[model samples]
Target chain A: MMLAQDTREPFFRPEWVSRNADRIVEQLIEHAYLTSIAVGVGSLIAIPVGVYAYRHRRAYVPVTWLAGFLYTIPSLALFAFLTTYTGLTTLTAEIGLVSYTLLILIRNVVAGLEGVPRDTREAARAMGYTPRQLLWRVELPLAFPVIMAGIRVATVTIIGLVTVTSLIGKGGLGKFILQGIQRFFSTPIVVGAVLSVLLAILADVLLLGLQRALTPWARSRPRPEGAR
Target chain B: MSVVSEALAWLSDPVNWSGTAGIPNRVFEHVRISTVTVLAAAMIAVPVGLLIGHTGKGRFVVVTLSNVGRAIPSFAILGLALPVAIKLNLGLGFWPTFIALFALAIPPILTNTYVGVAGVDPDLVEAARGMGMADREILRRLEVRLAAPVIMVGLRTASVEVVATATLAALVAGGGLGRFIIDGFAVRDDARILGGAILVAALAICTELFMGGVEKLARPRTSTA
Candidate 1:
């Protein structure tokens, strides 16, 4: 594939890196910040909602339905719609990004909680532990692996979606992508795409490590080889 | 209040409903592209996923592919594909967007098929074998039937995702309902943007609901004893 006919400017210019180093760092930082904040906020909202849904079987359907509906809204449309009220602010981007995480987190949270063994819960109750105590001590700890899995999925998804926030001028790696597209410059686009993908893989690996560290029991449990 | 009213007015405008760039035409483009992408993805993912599930090998590949798919932004893929497409003389718009959307649709379908098939009860498979069913017969009659709901879930996810992401086609000057949103951005027309968002959201919701219905129907009527 011949990249454009403009052979004067190389597809990847070494000098471009030197000149745009600061801007590249800033965009990477912005991307990380936006993704973390969105994931953080989403977990806060989704966990509680998931807990509520778990406690009340009736609410599970509606809660999941609403989240799923929000998830289905195109990221671009959500950002554009929010721009109407929020006016191209970081808040607008955050709202859209956070909303996408809810469905994944909530469903996972519930599934994790539900997957807790019935015997474990009964034993906890027999030990005279209050419901709240049982939840925090027994249930939540056991649910950590599943919940962490959800968080990993949500975090990775948010990282990808954060690129789209560049559409609203939020100055993430997506900004470089859009700029590169407009100018037909391959350097910035390649740099931005590669960095964003690396960031995603890094975040996923970090989360996996965190999950392993937190859920020691999960690691110790016997399992079929290569079950994952 | 005025925003909503203005968006309604724009949507209701008869002029917006006609012409090659009309709402209907744009929606058609959107649906047509999404349908083609989703079908293409399913055709490839389903068979591969089923094979992996049935044999219980290459499970690692599915997991890795799904992770990579989730990590790469669709926009990045679109951007990356564009220069290559242009370089290959595939032009600017449709093919690049189609390729990106196609990539987006594959992971979910593949993952779901693998999960569905793998999760089928071993006892059921054993019973089928005892009943003189061949491997192919067991897969088609027992595993596939039991795995249908999970497979449908994957299809529904891919469908909604493809439909929603197809909006980015406008970014590459391809046709879709996102034209309204992109054009509005260019001209700073709030009403047009909102109208476009509404249309996109409505389409997504409708697709989700329709697929959900299909899933429910595909579900086994009686417990798999």
Candidate 2:
């Protein structure tokens, strides 16, 4: 109904959704899978780097600068450039997606850990806690909310970036978007765009739930408004 | 390594420097669209941000909108816009690309402006009021002046983003440096693709540094005043 063309295909036909339900679900799963792998790998690398940067102080600038530099590269450009070497593999897609998450993940991890109150660490140390114990018990728990905030942002960002991967022949939901653009079909475009937005919202909400459930003691505190 | 060398060779080739599809023309197209999009977004966002920041009303809505806006992917916006553009007979490339990039650029400027302006010390506003200054005077002389740095941060963020995203304009038949990448892929020319990527990345970095310099300049002047 949204189209003015002679064919007049409805913007979102229920029959089309029913007929192509398998494809839609498959793309959704692919989108979610790519996002998780990127964020998961990104977090594994970022947390240790963040901890090191937090301790060394000198490492902070270089790590963040590298990440920011990578982030400034256009997603299309990165993916296109990578295709020459990596081919159309998911590895190519994951590398680009993971690179995008590094800035958000590392910055949040450092900020969250640093945000721990100084006096709390002092009090723990006064109680005969070891440096390791103080970090594990006193600092990380307090930093959990902030770290989780970074993860949520990274997750959402990766979901969006995954769409660009379709251009290189490896996107999940983005495949549909590219197909829609090429064919000039409203049904697929609407389906793809709507589902992608919904997926982002769903991921965000799920992470918020996880954040709240994990931090029972911090429940009384207000949530941070817009982590970035 | 050969990719890098070949890409450099492609960039350094004098033949690639002329014509409508040349490096200069593509860079011009890229900069033109990005500048217009950022400027258009600012014209709308800055005033609305000023109102929200100064009045202390609609803070929650604007913040929530920015949060949602951040989550929406640029490609999705472009995909959605393409159909509407076609339906409206707005042609293919530039209009859809502009609409998408414009949407992408607004949130940072609006949020930054609001945060910068709203964060001005209320006590300063009160003092300005005591001096018989109107709300407009207080906003222009005091709040906006203090908030300039934050607003610039927003502009810098938005500018860098716009420049980076403008590359996608090529995908929709629009002319830009992105044409090299898209066209490179079409003809399987790795050198041209990498060369184009380098150009786009370099442009984005220059925008970041330039805006940062502007931000620094804006900062010291206000403090000295």
Candidate 3:
């Protein structure tokens, strides 16, 4: 607070903080919204595909691997390439982001679902539970831990990647960073960079909390008495 | 549209492969740049990771720092660093790209290295010490050998990711295969876009295969587990 008075630059001046505070808050919210939307959409798309593939086992390996490969494409290039067909707009960016997430989320979901100990599902089936009941009451609950771990990783990764969405002209912190670069001003760039780190941290913490909430079983189980 | 045909023609032209316009040369340079960055990041990340794991000190510090590295988002790092580079007249291109990709690649290498080493059977290490192996020898002869496969898996994944991501360096006008994809946008060339995408995808798979073979060769068989 004390250092700002010596700055000759207007934006760097102390008084500007009051004016920009709301915008910064709003920008952070907007950034969070965009990332959450992509994750939500990716989950919707991926869950069924993941479940279906997990059911079919051997047959889906090629297709799921293809999804994983596509998931590995760098976000920036994918957005730009999509823009050639879709044009530079929100739809293209959204589609690219969602597609990118599906690869991670779906594979994780499928892996998690498959990871459900076979005995549990068999017990559910033996107890005369319907297939739907098995999924909802048995498999889903047991699989929740691994599924959320995947989502947690995916969310943190997306929050960081969303900063690049500004390059496609989505007008978030990235725009400020890019503009600061163009104008040779470091404050806006610094603001963007600092917030990018903060955003990643906050997102990880939030998702970690959610993971814990969903996976109570993971923590409740103790390590074997003698184990490291 | 036609730009695709043109680029294809250019690429297919015997002259393109003959190193004219430094296309072949540029390909080698880009590969070299990307490969060196991945190796360099691994060199720094692996030992630091191994040290942290072997010592079992500052566990939180090491992990929290790696998480920050993972979270820093490559483009923002590049954006933040570029102005500093430009003003200092360090200029921008491969080195800047190398730094950014290196930062992005480290977390995977670091995390995997830590997991590979720390996850080793404690009893085995104890036995090795009981057998009177020196600390240095224990690390090189047993611990690292036991950990090699997992660490190599991480390197294999990280290298593919780095090559794909080095494409982003194009935004700052750093040359790589990303040019074909980004430039394809201005002209609306799907073929060029697809070609570039295919090339990147191929680059990833090729690196994975190459690394997988090396991983197998280095990995000790008949686990002492």
Among these predictions, the greatest DockQ belongs to: 2
Tens-digit lDDT track of model 3 for A114-216: 7787777888899999998998888778778777777877787777777777756774566666666556455677777778778878877888898788777
Name the fnat for model 3: 0.40
Error of 2 at B14 (Å): 1.2
Question: What CAPRI-style quality would you assign to candidate 3?
Answer: acceptable
Candidate 2, residues B43-143, lDDT tens digits: the string is: 99999999999999999977887987877788888887787777777878899888888888889999999999999988989999999999999989888
Question: Where does candidate 1 stray beyond 4 Å?
Answer: A1-15, A117-128, A215-228, B55-58, B120-146, B220-225
**lDDT (CA) for every model shown?**
0.88, 0.88, 0.73
Q: Residue A206 CA error for candidate 2 (Å)?
A: 1.5
User: Candidate 3 chain A: minimum summed lDDT over ten consecutive residues — where?
Assistant: A1-10
What tens digits encode model 3's per-residue C-alpha lDDT throughout B1-225?
Answer: 454465566557575455423356545655877899888988998998787778887678668866777677676777766555655556667666776778777888888788888888999999999999998888888878888888898788788778777776666667877766666654766666655655666666677778889888877878553
Q: Give the TM-score of candidate 2.
A: 0.93
| Sort order, TM-score high to low | 2, 1, 3
Candidate 2 docking class: medium
Which residue pairs overlap in candidate 1's backbone? none
- Measured against the native two-chain assembly using Cα atoms, what DockQ does each of the candidate structures obtain, in the order listed? 0.55, 0.63, 0.36
